[model samples]
Target: MIMYTAGDVRVEERPDPKIIEPTDAIIRLTATCICGSDLWPYRGVEPADHTAMGHEYVGVVEAVGDDVRNVKVGDFVVGSFVISDNTCEICRSGYQSGCVHREFVAGTIGTQAEKARIPHADGTLVPTPGQPDEDLIPSLLAASDVLGTGWYGAVAAEAGPGRTVAVVGDGAVGLMAVLAAKQLGAERIIAMSRHPDRQELARFYGATDIVEERGDAGVARVKELTDGLGAHSVVEAVGTQESTMQAINSTRPGGRLGFVGVNYDVTIPGIDLFFAGIHVEGGPAPVRRFLPELIQLIWDRKIDPGRVFDLALPLDEAAQGYKVMDERRATKVLLTL
Candidate 1:
């Protein structure tokens, strides 16, 4: 799939990818998904400039460079959106997304096609325990991005036993954060959403409460649930000025806030954060750090993260996948090859 401009995506035959670096690998994609970040360009919030689209993918390794040791041809693999050498100081420090030798997969070549070339293959790709069942493909594919991102959000927010965790936004990431919070043993999980379908999914993901309000009213509801002390942790999954403030104000003083939303026109007020006395930590999630554990959970059928993909289409209808997601008609769209 290629994006010539906002709202204009096409399925065209692109040249087959080849191993360009000693650490590179070529993958034949079995599954890919349209991410929330992809909407930035789809809605014209960011420039497309005829760029290739898609980052989340699960596929079979077709070939690997001589230097690649961890993965080889015919291995069913999942990789992070950001390629990392996994030996750089930043990557070793658990920030692979910001590694010294990092390159975003979408910027180089798209996965929403028959094939894609992955750089730093050994460090970036994780092989599954074995070939996954047909039904498990969607869940495993989700581990490539959204599920890992939400897990990072919950961890960064310090959601755990005895903590009251509140999540802002009910998108795929937010819903996944609810699952993470539940898995982490959060005492109370409050999901703020007005959409019935998402609210149901949040509840299924272990959200104990729901706040149908937004902005200040939503913040008030969260405080009320927390006995006026606010929540112990807050996950901000919608990147907007209002959502950011909602997450900040909904947390207790000295609490932590994890923001994983793909920020658009967002600006954080220095004074408000200082007075709030909260610790905020977030960026593109270092998905590589969590891939192993997440893969195991999916393989064992402990979590069904694929529930986020409400729409599935063949690769040829890539444009429709973008359309439904942009219009909020689908929680997430899965493209099958």
Candidate 2:
């Protein structure tokens, strides 16, 4: 799929990508999806003009360059949205998204096509145990981005036993975070959403509480639930300034606030943040770090993150997928090849 301009996307023919480096690999995509992050460009918050779209994907390896060792051609694989040389020092420390040679795979290298060239194959791509069942494909594709991202968000917030975890957005990422919090053993999981469908999904994912307010009302409701002590961990899935502050205010002193939403216009007040006394950690998720376990969870039928994709369309209707997501008609859109 190519974005001809802001709010305009269409499937345009392009040359099949080829390996550009010895570490590169070419894969024929089986499935891909539109992300909330993609809306940043679609909504024109960021520039877009004849730009390639999409990053989340799952596929079979068609070819690999000489230096690639971990995965061979014909392997079923899933990769992080951010390309990374997982061998780098930063990656070695479990932050592959911050690798010295990191490159975002979205705008620059769109995987929403039939095939794509993946750099740092051994580091960025993780092949499945085997050819997944047809029904498992969507879950596997999700592990490439949203699932891994939400898992990272929960981990960053330190959602664990005896803790009360609150999620700040009702989008796919936020829902994933709720699932992660449950798997991580949080004592109480709070999902803040005004949408009924999302609220129902949140309950399915183990949300014990739901706050239908926003801004100060949302913060007050959280505090009320926590006995005036806010939640132990708060995951901020929305990137606006209001949501950022809402997440921060919803955390108790010395608590954790994990922000996975792509911050576009968030600017915190230095004085308030200083006195907030909370631990904050967030950014482009190091999805490669969590892909292995996430894939296993889906493979084992322990989690069904694929339920987040409510709309499915062929690659030819990529425009409709973008339209539905931009209008919030679909929580997430799956593009079938």
Candidate 3:
């Protein structure tokens, strides 16, 4: 997929990716998908500039560089959206997304094509237990980004036993956050949304409450459910200023807020943040850090993140995929190769 300009993406033939670094490996992607983040550039919120698209992928290693040893040709693997050495001090501290050598996989190495070249393969890719079944591909592919992102949001918010986790978005990431909060043992998961379909899915993902309201009304509903103290943990998967503030106001003092949304214009006054006195953690999720555990859960059939893809189109139809998402017609679109 190539975006010639904002809202003008098309599937165009591009040069095939080959190893340019000894630490690189080329993989024949079996599955790839359009992400919520992809919409930023597509919607003109971010630059497109004839950019190559897609970052989430799952595939078989087609070839490997001499320096690569962790995975070999024929290995079915999943990699992170961000490339990381996975050995630097930051990565060792569990923040691979912030590694000294970090590189985003989006525009530089578009995985929406039949194949892609991956750098830092040793640290970025994790092979599955074995060859995955056809039905498992989507779920496995999801571990590359959305599922891992949601899991990070949950973990950052400290969603666990006796905690009330309120997710302030009903997109794929938000729905996945609801699932993550459940897996993390959050006692009450509150999914904030007005969409009936999303609300239903949230329930299936273990949400005990739903806030159909927005802004102040939404915060009041959450507070009502939490006895006016606000939720113990709040996940902000929507990156707008309104959504961010809603998440902040919905959190109790001394509670935690995990923000995984990718909006750039969101700003908060220092006084408000200082007075809120809430613990805040968020940013691009370190998906590589949780790939192992997420893969296991999917392999064991403990969670079905694949259901998040309500729309599927061949790689050629990515333009339509972007349209549907931009128009709110689909929560997610899985681009099949």
Maximum-lDDT candidate = 2
Q: Which ten residues in a row have the lowest lDDT in candidate 3?
A: 9-18
Mind giving the per-residue lDDT tens digits that candidate 1 earns over 221-271? Answer: 999998899999999999999999999999899999999998878998899
> Model 1 scores what on Cα lDDT?
0.93
What residue runs in model 3 are displaced by over 4 Å at the alpha carbon? none
The whole-model C-alpha lDDT of candidate 2 against the native structure comes to 0.95
Residue 263 of candidate 2: its Cα lDDT? 94
True lDDT of residue 313, candidate 2: 97
- The ten-residue window of minimal lDDT in model 2 covers 264-273
What is the Cα-based TM-score of model 3?
0.99
Error of 1 at 307 (Å): 0.7
- After aligning candidate 3 to the native by TM-score, how far in Å is the CA of 16 from where it should be? 1.7
lDDT of each: 0.93, 0.95, 0.94
The reply for model 1, stretches above 4 Å from the true place, is none
Error of 1 at 120 (Å): 0.2
Q: Give lDDT: candidate 2, residue 65.
A: 97
Clashing residue pairs in candidate 3 are none
